[model samples]
Target: MKVKVLVAAIGVLAVMVLVGCGGGETSTTASTAASGSTETTAAETATSAQPTKASITVGVLVPQTGFAANYGPEAQQGIDMALAEMGVDSGVEVKIITADEDVLDASNTLERLKKMVETDGAQIVIGPVFGSSQQAVAPYLTQAKIPWFSFLGASKDLAGSGGTAFVWPGADQLTAGPLGDYAAKTLGYKKIATLAPDYAYGHDSITGATDTFTAAGGKVIQQQWVPLGTTDMLQYATKIDKNADALLMWLVPSDAASFVKEYRNLGVKIPLLMFLGIFDPTFQEVGDLLVGEIGLNEYNPNLDNARNTAFVQSYKAKYNAIPNQTTAFAYTVMENIIQGVQKSGGKTSVEDLRAAMNGMALDTVIGPATYSPDGIASSNRYIVKAAQAADKTYIWDPIETYENVGAPK
Candidate 1:
């Protein structure tokens, strides 16, 4: 009986061991399967967790249907050119929104800017072409944390304030310094006569010329400020008499044309130096009357650079329109922003894009371009002579190219 009981106990113990081994194997298999499942789920979640799509919405804050309507289509043409170069594909969509800022009143200007920023949700802003409009939009843009760039005559009042706005070609210095220096040093002009519209743009330009010319051992013999849109400028032309070596006229399109017409009529033989606005379509109405005028241009259509040549060809083909200097600057601005976005992996955040813009150095059709945090564009300036093209329209022939005028140190 004792032998039989011991054998039975041994058999019971063997069965128990077999059951425990089997259970252990099953548990290990289950844990391995669970771990694999967990890893697959995590990978799936990661694949689904990418950031949302980015769309580029730029606010064209120019006067499209107001006093500056002549400049409206030109501004739009610039943006269109930039968008084409940027290439809207691979999750980037460029949307341009336009606003009309009435050039007559400050309130209307501010209202239009506010609509573009708040109502339209524009991440970038282009213009409000006049000085007053730019001044009106400054505080709003600063508070809203939106970047604003303008195309107008330089205003020192707009600069040095740590504002959210930047002026291309650096308002006063870029426009006036080079022109003044060229006249003073290269052309050997001792006495310069100045005439510009009585406004911030004209005043700032005159101030820049005055300061730079004086510093470079040149004398400003006489300075005259005239009201804008003055139809009869024979009286002003009479101011450009035998005493002045050269006349630096800084009027806008209409007034400048009038002055040029009257100067020719009055037979004033002194060489005239003027700004970009002096060569607008209206001035071309005066035709060969402005054959020998020497001026500073924003960008010369006849500049024989690879970029300018391509731009002109593309512009004519794409829009069936003649390109101008303002449009060129506008194109440069948009291209600069698009490059910044592309470099940042298409980031939509303003801060990231701003950082990208600050670090960017672009090769523009106008010339080399770079911007500062203060919103100043330190691009090159062009000096050109007005010559009638074979097409019988006035075109600027680039005489000197000051490449990279405002490069940061």
Candidate 2:
């Protein structure tokens, strides 16, 4: 089953890439200084005024082939969509550097980052998609002073750590708060147990959700932390065979499916809820296991907006499938960068680009998004339940919405 699934996934990705790059033009440009933005006296200004280059090079690093590969291609697709819509150019060449986060080890992932910065000449870096990989790469990006836009796991360590790294979405706070509130108020779940990987990403997510839920009068009965890449979660399921109202599960596609299957096998029939990772297409392979399951999304593709609808349609037409948060967030990252470039009139300096990004607010396909100086996104989050109506297709329907956290008004 594993081999067959792996082969099928590869085949699907090959088709998606060709479709993604087809619509976009070859966008690039050279820099020209703003009429009056630089601060310098006449003599000092004469020598200090260096023209703003029109071309931009963004380094996109995601786990395209490893554990987090599910979201990697979707991230690239989002970037491509932004480039097509924004039409940014100035003799300004926008070059993309794609790197794989070999989730098998940290050293291999570090090597990938070094290649992106040194050999690829990617002045701006976009991602290192997994929490473990992000932690491994964070210190290096700090020393290099390279501006990186994080698009993957919402680890608290990345927030306010004071480096070139800026986190999109309040990571743990954004996802967990809305979800916990819904589980408490709407579902009336008095007691819940969280099952997640025993790592920075999983631990932080559980902490964030349980903290918020408990504060809202919901009781967390237990917490289970399993090792990453564990094939069987039956032990975890057996542990949860008790009287909990719901299960807050945090696992990638493979393990998530294992949890669902094991829960059913063990006759543990409580409601299952998951984080953004549940948005992957691979979940569909489990069929009935996901029906009626609740999932929280920082980015929901079902949003009834022009950009979002178009994104969903285009993605479906190309891949014959729907998109998840990974795709939506990835595309948002690229779109934000494109907007910054256009606002800067094709400026290329890392400092200038970062400032422009910080100042500008973006209307994303999902919703209104703006980055705080602390580098977290202030945006709404949605509580979605898996529903399949007469259409015979599974989709996420929103139950509640949460406002922006960790950002100033």
| Candidate that would win on lDDT | 2
- Badly placed stretches (over 4 Å) of model 2 are 1-53, 88-92, 159-161, 345-351, 406-409
**Which run of 10 residues does model 1 get worst, by summed lDDT?**
22-31
Q: What does candidate 2 score on TM?
A: 0.81
Model 2 lDDT on a 0 to 1 scale = 0.67
Q: List, residue by residue over 29-124, the lDDT tens digit for candidate 1.
A: 332343244323333332344432455667776654422456766766676666555543323455566666555455666776676668767787
Cα deviation of 334, candidate 1, in Å: 1.7
- RMSD in Å for all candidates: 27.0, 10.2
